[model samples]
Target chain A: MPLDLPNPTDLAVPGFIVLMLAEMIYGRMSGRAVYEGKDTLTSLLMGTGSVVAGLIPAGLGYGAAYYIWSEWRLFDLGHAWWVFVVAFVLDDLAYYWVHRFGHRMRWMWAAHVIHHSSQHYNLSTALRQTWTGKLTPGFIFALPLAFLGFEPAIIAFVSGINLIYQFWIHTEAIDRMPRWFEAVMNTPSHHRVHHATNPDYLDANYAGVFIIWDKMFGTFIPEDKANNPCRYGLVHDLGTFNPLRVAVHEWVGIVRDMWHAKGLKNKLMFLIGPPGWTPDGSRMTSDMIKEDWKRRQAVKEAAPANIAAE
Target chain B: MSLLQLLGSVIAVFIVAAIARWLFPVRFRLEDAHLHRELERVYPDLEPEEILIDRAGNAALLRLSGARGIVVVRRLGDKAVLRHWMPGTKVTATRTPTGLMLDTDDFTEPKIVLDLDAEGVSRTESWLALLAAPDGHAHAA
Candidate 1:
């Protein structure tokens, strides 16, 4: 029997409206304002950017899938329901990589930085997304799922579900879940670690619905209540709530650094190098500062009288 | 398109639009009424040109164009007096591949100054680099 095609757009509207309304009510109840002036605009811009980023590649994915499936009449995958499940799993698997790369890569980080720039993590934070991400990484992996006898609708629906499920995990209101559930799923606790800028928690957990990927990939670090309390946000915090700044601050910083760097090496390092890599032979890493202090101490000991006179 | 197909297409388009709107909004209205009121109080003589609220830095830069001189105030808390536009002095900074270079020839010979504070101070040769290129133009190779 043919699988009944559910409208992907229909599912998204109700889900988005419900989420927004829920965020507002919860925000009020929790004594957290839903939208801060200027922040609301920033959030909205970031949200729109993410959708635009997702849509370009997603649109192409749908077009190519439709072309191949229609040509071959490969719609009848015998086990349509199981195929949907497999598609969903594959989508989640792809998302895990996309999510991880967004954290690890410098260019990808620029787009993703907007999402984490907000110190306050709430439902609205989930909406803060990047518009230019698609141009950078490009969603090419989804093509394989389309090639493997899955309809575009199924793929789109599964992708939407994966995104929708991750929203509730953005809040601090929900603490630890049951032991068993936390063991297998990417709960809020795990996600808090992911969002934290703490030294130990950086680049730790990268999972969508399942924690298995992080566990399997050796990226999984459990919530250590004593050692690491999740301190939300990036290292060089963007202090303003302005959305446009939140979205393009890194880009501006990149251009600024690139312009000021003296050589090609410094220019490339500023744009494509790891975050906080400066041309002054100085690094922002914790270890670098410790070494600098040690060097100063050694100098002071070597010339105690000179140091005291100064 | 069949009935199901038509429904699916409409649904897909709508969902994409909603997500787009949810993610990238153009205008940002004030979320807190109190904050808005406070901003108004801080800048009672706020001219439209002086109200520089840029979203890119998450900080607003305001320049009060007064008779005496321009007063620059950063939204986060830094207030400084900008030097009046001198005939020979350059006000704009240009970026380059290398470190910043100043336009003035006086920058050819730069001096390093180290101010003493709670933290012990140390002066390096590089401190003169900024002064050497005081024109604010970045000279990139």
Candidate 2:
């Protein structure tokens, strides 16, 4: 079969439907609401957009890798099996960095924020992905796998497995496990922390299947139900279920802020600053913008009546 | 497969094993003995009236009904946080004379089973049930 041809994993239609059904069942069982009309439709649309965008480049990358690896047999590496293993790990390791960067960089966050836009964390939230994400800087990670002499099919399969493992962790149904399991692997608790908008938990855990990367890099934060409740969604919610708005909301916000910026430094800050970071004279972080707005309103109301009465 | 291929296959198998261990993982459950011991330590005052283990053995749902009310502690991993609470109202009150009937509808809705024992019973079961009704209160409408 031609490497570029669609495979079972590529046609994730069945998996997507199954995921929706599972989310509904699990959500109801856990006393959480299932898809509420428009949100369900919006999530489906946004997820479809993300998948379409992601597949195009991914398909091209796979075809190129397959051609090169099958033709050049670049390394004198003796075992086909060993080559596959190394390629898979290397891809995952690269994925860890890519996933980390997606959170750290504003440009990447525009695409990634779709996944976190849901206020209620459920399986549908997992499907609320961004089609524009593949256009980000780190999609280049596939090149390294290509250079490493692994067939694109193998690379794609390994990447698919990594993604599949992430699905079940999207639930609140499963809690903690054995100490050793949690200490090493990324459990539901760890992922819950990752999805939380709490300052203490924001961007703390960024592992895929193995949390060793987060632990090693010092990004891991254990779930503390007492001190840190997992509040789902971003600090400033989009407040709408429109997929177009969800996909480009941050990008639009970035452009507007950049345009209003008074200086080159502020303009750059608008682009590169953390998701909520802003350059207004008030020096308010994006996460605190709503609070600042309320505080300003309160101050306005508290001003001396005579001064305004004139 | 030649000697070189054999060596390569062995190496490949180990690498795949490591990746599998990293992803699509299997985890160890918190043993019932350990969970009982921890619950005892956390809530030394109340005795565990009943312990319900899920079929998968991944989580243990403990119900501690005392004079205070009902305390549901879900034990997952090393943590046994307060999962649900109902206070002041007798557990028997919610249960019919035959015992609390298992309503599949209850499982269908998203209800916050409060830890009433800790803070006192602030809301009634009927109130909570209404709040959790699937007519869609949780979603931002």
lDDT of each: 0.57, 0.59
- Model 2's chain B yields a TM-score of 0.37
User: Can you tell me which runs of candidate 2 are displaced by over 4 Å?
Assistant: A1-8, A11-13, A30-35, A55-79, A263-265, A280-310, B1-141
CAPRI-style docking class of model 2 based on DockQ: incorrect
- State the lDDT of candidate 1 residue by residue for B43-139, as single tens digits: 3333322333322322222332332212122232111111122222333333333222222222111111112222211111122232234442324
For model 2, how does the per-residue alpha-carbon lDDT over B18-111 read when each residue is reduced to its tens digit?
4323332334454568666755533445666555543344444454544233334332222333333333222322433322222211111112
Q: Tell me the deviation in Å of residue B141 in model 2.
A: 40
Relative to the true structure, candidate 2 reaches a TM of 0.57
i-RMSD of all predictions: 12.7, 17.5
* True lDDT of residue B34, candidate 1: 29
- Candidate 1 segments exceeding 4 Å error: A1-10, A13-37, A52-79, A225-227, A255-273, A277-310, B1-141
Isolated chain B TM-score per model: 0.21, 0.37
